[model samples]
Target: MANESVTLRQIARKVGVSVGTVSRALAGENGVSDRRAHAIQDLAKQMGYRPQPLRRQRAGAIAVLVGTSESGHPDEDWSQRLIVLATRASAELSWHVHLEFVSRNDDSRRAVAVPTVVRENRVDGVLLAGDPHSSIIEYLHRHEIPMAMVGGRAEKTGCVCVNPDREQAVRTAIHRLFELGHRCFGVVLSDRRYPSTEAFYQNCRQSLADHGIELSPRQVLENLQPNLGGGVIAARRYLAAGEPLPTAMLFTNDWMALGAMMTLLEAGFRVPRDVSIIGQDNLPWCNQMEPALCSMDNREERMVREALVWLRRRIEGSPCEPHDVTVHSELVWRGSCGPAPRGSAPNGAGPNGAGVTSPAPAKSRQADPSSISLASPPGAS
Candidate 1:
């Protein structure tokens, strides 16, 4: 009997208990006395009665909370990608995935006012899909909830965060543009409050400084929305600024870049002809545009996978230090960017020598000018 087909029935027979009692004991379920459960579990272990994988215990479903816009709609492109990837990963792990949308503009104090899922205790953990307020994060910590952040850093709160290397991605963009002979540069950003947005701005400024170039205050266009309308507004501002526009402009994301591209075309400023442009988040539509958008590929799939892994570890009661996982981005060169416009100074030209005149002092630290590094792109002399 010990050598032949070890089963719960065999264990029950050996322990003088019913199969139900054996099952409950092996599963650590209540109803069986602690002493009896321990004895049955030990007997099953000794009798080589292995539990089937299909009956393995699970930590329950995870909740993915995404931030919605002012209109109460989540960013479809970003939110969808994260949900799909997380769902797929959860399926493989035999865990369920539940998605919840929260407003980006919600007051931090109000955001944690007992979400229905939390009150019902439906999920074992949470994956914050975007930059939620620190207050909400702190609330989760106080409740002893297992949580991980995606697409934003949460180092202060000791949450494991998975994000694209924004600084390095911006640096790569600058280097690529420099290689293409673009010295003078500009950027269009929205939502200064977002950590990701601030990172992009700071990194872009720092990268230019490292290349011996100055990012003038006028070069940055801010206070716009994150959508196409924002792009249109930014375009209007750029056109109104008059002559000597920076030869290369970087949009915070693809939507704005495409929107601005349409506006630029309508204004008779031929893209890559009058002013080259680059965007981030290499969205699918980028390639279909009149001129394919040159942007950074943020590797959304990898970002989600990393976030889920950390979340699963937390759910399993694994001990891990707070970690910041950075997935590097790739530069997707497209027709949107080209060599600097004619008469523009070459790549190594200083701010004064470039076609762009240095604007007034920057009000923010990101605008501070610094000396250029001797670093050259790979294979450059």
Candidate 2:
């Protein structure tokens, strides 16, 4: 067996930090960055060193996620936005933000390829931005790591969650559309399956049902990417079907919404008048459209703030609320929706499809915004 007489001096030397820093971190002081604090603490324990007063320091926020190539990561900006927010937030809290993108297949062959930060035991707690993968969840729980999931479900145990009220989002969107006299509805979803997307799809279909509207199987599109290109394909696919399109369409995200709008316009359709369309995330592009795209805001900004507050409480050994927290979504109404058209045209009936050309749109969604951001997700200082 290894000797158990390891000292703080040895631990500090091994961690490559000053003794005072180690003491402060191990004693649970607030100044050190959480990543460093967790790293130092883990090293000390590994060397059989014990901290005085048995305190644990946690002042770091790490963005643990499965990363795809940039092309596959359509939400890259979304992740970046969260980092910027976390950095700014942590600065206010005098904490540090850590980030590392774990490849999707990184741990496929290993039993549990824990993140470097977690394996090192650097943070007293971990804040999960969303549901990573099952492997990630299992690793955290098996290690008994304290974690708080924002915008995602908490795993089996030792975890808390801050989730978006997607049901409320659906309800709010449907109510708004109904009040605007839009009876026929359609939905476009991201081709891939994600917890958020699945939730949105289910809630939206259910909400429409609750409002006495029928969302036929064909009216829903879920075969394209979750980005602009996907939206473009969706519009084309709908046109090829030669079905009478709904008066209102809902996109899972703004990118897809913008794409569909552009395609529909090119095919001689008037937005809102021909088809009122809205999307989720309320991205910056919403304002750039000639008639801004209305959107359901996920309130990720508020969720991040709340998650940070919760993390601080947990790491600092302070009183914290229950294990679950919810951030309700809000719908930001804009020009993308209006009174339903008296007569709806089939996609194949548009000008590009051998039909009479539509009149010049009152407000074309063709003017490109110089800058646009698909807004979603945030957290803490």
Candidate 3:
């Protein structure tokens, strides 16, 4: 009988006990009587029973590090989704993830803080939420830690990068606005160190140039904050000038769009009525607002999911290719843009406030101070 296949119930019968008592005794995981545990272990050895592998019990953990300030409105939705997916995927492979938020208050301090986390093995891998934190990239590489970045480029080797094709995204937005007859363009953005901002301006310039339009530094407003207050600031100055306001405005993000909407309403301008507005990051606010914001659309869930898959593979010593992915954004046209106002000049119109009527190629007349060319294509005269 001992040499034959023996189930827990058979062992319980042999021991004159319940299956529960036999299981507790065989586990030998404490709280069991010495005599019962010894008997269960001896019986299990006789029955050729063995414990499960220890690796199956170990679920590894990864860490998520965010570069932005915590106090600031942490756009965790993007990172949160990534963590959730990673967490579930890890469960399949018997792994887990731990999230950590890192501050960029001082660039110098950022470098030191990252490697320390790696040396301590606090997180098996790291996921940078938004924009590339170059300092952390350098530190992690130095320690040979696996890491992934979403929404920005990664300079380090073996680092997986997932982000939207910003240039293409911006081009899509501008192209749609142009199709809607928006010749005068207004841009609201934060004057920050983010690469997305740089890409945005570059793409905006390239898109307009493709359409034979040129924008001056002044024509494109740069505010430190990409929030409502920033939009109000730009709009107030633009409106107070009493000059012809831009028929359309493109913000770096949705928060600024909210500000622009409020400012336009206060200044007696109806959205898509007097001026059209568009923004990036189709946040929830876009649909929640009364008129709803018109902006770029992104598959944030896809980005997060793919990033985690890549990170998991790299963590497990699997041969994973380092990839640079660019998710394209589609311009969702709502009630924001329309035909150019009657009598408005074409792409290369005069400056918004300079009060100088001019026409033709902007480059040829850019040197001439007397002729003010408003690169923003206004929809109205």
Candidate 1, run of 10 with poorest lDDT: 365-374
Candidate 3 at 255: error in angstroms?
1.6
Lowest summed lDDT across 10 adjacent residues in model 2 is found at 350-359
> How well does each candidate superpose onto the true structure, as a TM-score?
0.73, 0.70, 0.68
Q: What lDDT score goes with residue 295 in model 2?
A: 89
lDDT of 3: 0.63
Report lDDT (Cα) of residue 122, candidate 2.
64
Estimate the Cα RMSD of every predicted model relative to the unseen true structure.
14.2, 10.2, 16.0
Model 2 / residue 276 / CA error / Å: 0.7
Model 2 residue runs over 4 Å out of place are 1-75, 104-112, 155-158, 318-322, 344-381
lDDT of 1 at 214: 77
Q: Report lDDT per candidate.
A: 0.71, 0.65, 0.63
Model 1 CA lDDT for position 100 = 78
Error of 1 at 334 (Å): 1.3
Query: Residues 258-370, candidate 1, lDDT per residue (tens digit)?
Result: 77877766665667766788888898777766567888988888888888888888888999788788888888888888777666656546543445532222232232111
Q: Pick the lDDT winner.
A: 1
Which residue runs does candidate 3 get wrong by more than 4 Å?
1-59, 70-95, 105-110, 115-117, 131-135, 156-158, 240-243, 320-323, 352-381
Alpha-carbon error at 108 in model 2, in Å? 6.6
